[model samples]
Structures are given as C-alpha cells and as structure tokens.
Target: MDRRTACLHQANAFREKALADPEHHDQWIDEAIKWLERAMEASCRAVITMEGDDGSDAPAPAFETMAPHRRVIVRQ
Candidate 1:
C-alpha cells in the first residue's frame, strides 16, 4: 500500500486497541477529539491572518474571555 494509506491503517489499528480498554476509553476519546479540533483550527488559521497585530503577543481572547469555556479537573 501507499505510505499514506499504510499510516492511516496503523492509526486505525492503534485506536481500536485503545477503545478495547474500558478504563482509558473516555479519556482517550476526549483527547482524540481535542487533537482533531486543533488540526481543523490550525488549517483554518492558515487561510488568513485572524487579526492585525494588536500590539501585544497575547492570544486575541484574553484569559478571562476564555474562562467560561475552560475545563478544569482536580486529580487526587
């Protein structure tokens, strides 16, 4: 098979293995979703500069602005 197809097949096989472990299943799924979302976001960002240099090197959304959508979990 071609290199890309082979890589995809290997990734699918690994994902299947992860899904078989119930204890880690949900966490793995959440991480997979996050990675996919990041990939999509990066692709879109590549199409255009989101904003002109607004003076600061910080993210457009201030930390407070994103607080509402943030997820926090305290582990023992």
Candidate 2:
C-alpha cells in the first residue's frame, strides 16, 4: 500500500480503538489525527510531484500557488 493509504489505515485503527476504550480515548484520537494529517500531507506532495512544472499536463494551481514552507490548507 502507498504511504498515504498506510497512514490512513493506522489512523482508522486508532480511531476504532479510541471508540472501544474510553480510558485512552483522548490519546488515541490525538494519534489518529496526527496520522491523518501525515496522510493528507503525503497525498498533497505526491500530487504536486506528479504534476510537472513544465506544464506538460494540466496546470496544477494548488501546487503552483503554494509557497515554500507554507502549509497546505485542507478543508474537511
């Protein structure tokens, strides 16, 4: 599986565990959020890398508009 997928799987696992165990709910939820964020960042980076800067394929506005060191904003 891809890194993104793996990360998402881990997040899901944590989420499930959190639902089952109330004692560690906050900790598991926090871990799940971290994994989900990692997955999202990796997915965004992959998409940016796939789109060449030479404009060979369609223009990637999201990737092109991003500045170095700027975090990508993802809306749920």
Candidate 3:
C-alpha cells in the first residue's frame, strides 16, 4: 500500500484502540496524528518532486503521476 493508505490504516487502528481504552486515548491520538503528519509530508514531497521542483541534480521525470489522496498535502 501507498504511504497515505498505510497512514490511514495506522490511524484507524489507533482510533479503534482509543475508543476501547479512554485512559490511553491520548497516546493513541498522538500516534495517529504523527502518522497523518508523515503521510502529508510524504505527499508534499512527492508533489514537489513530481512537478520538477525537487532541487536534485538528477533529471526530472518525463511524466508524473500522483497517488490517491494526494490532496491531503494541500488541505494541510
């Protein structure tokens, strides 16, 4: 699975645990948020790279394609 999908799976797992254990919800939420933030950062980097703004010495991709839920980066 892609980064976004993996992050979402992690978030859902945390959510399920949070619902069952209110005392540990804080930790679960923190973990979930971190996964989400990482996913968004990954997506942003992907977008910039796809757009040929990666600032790398290597050549740009001849064609670019984004994964699903790439909009999360913009929404963030």
Candidate 4:
C-alpha cells in the first residue's frame, strides 16, 4: 500500500482503539489525529508527484509563477 493508504489504515486503527478503550482514549485519539495529518500530507505529495499525460514525471510548476486563474492547471 502507498504511504497515504498506510497512514489512513493506521489512523482508522487508532480511532477504533480509542473508541473501544476508555482508559487510553486521549492517547489513541491523539495518535489517530497525527496519523490523519500524515495521510493528508502524503496525499498532497502524491498529487504533486503525479506523472503528466506525456508519461514524464516532471515536477509541478511553482505557484508563484502561475497566474491566479491558471494555478491549478497541470501542463504536460
């Protein structure tokens, strides 16, 4: 599994444990939140590293160089 999926699985496990164990609720909840944040970061990284239609794994353009209306466009 990818980093994002792994992190999400970890988060879910933590959440389930938190719900089931009242004694360590705080610790499990905190861990779950941390894993969720990691998953989100991994997802963002995946999007940034996505290959172009030309099959080239080029880096995405800098946000500063893009116009407001074109910032979301991914050029090949």
What lDDT score belongs to each candidate, Candidate 1 first?
0.49, 0.78, 0.71, 0.76
Candidate 3, 14-34: lDDT as tens digits: 888888899999998888888
Model 2 regions lying over 4 Å from their true place? 47-76
Q: Compare candidates 3 and 4 on lDDT and give the better one.
A: 4
Q: For model 2, give the 10-residue run with minimal summed lDDT.
A: 60-69
> Candidate 3 has what TM-score?
0.57
lDDT, candidate 4, 4-54, per-residue tens: 899999999999999999999999999999999888776655233343567
Alpha-carbon shift of residue 21 in model 3 (angstroms): 0.7
The per-candidate count of clashes, in order, stands at 0, 0, 0, 0
* lDDT by residue for model 2 (5-67), tens: 999999999999999999999999999999998887766652333334785767655443433
CA lDDT of 26 in candidate 2?
100
Ranking by lDDT: 2, 4, 3, 1
| TM-score to true structure, per model | 0.38, 0.60, 0.57, 0.62
Q: Best-fitting candidate, measured by lDDT?
A: 2
The lDDT of model 1 is 0.49
10 residues in a row with least lDDT, candidate 4: 63-72
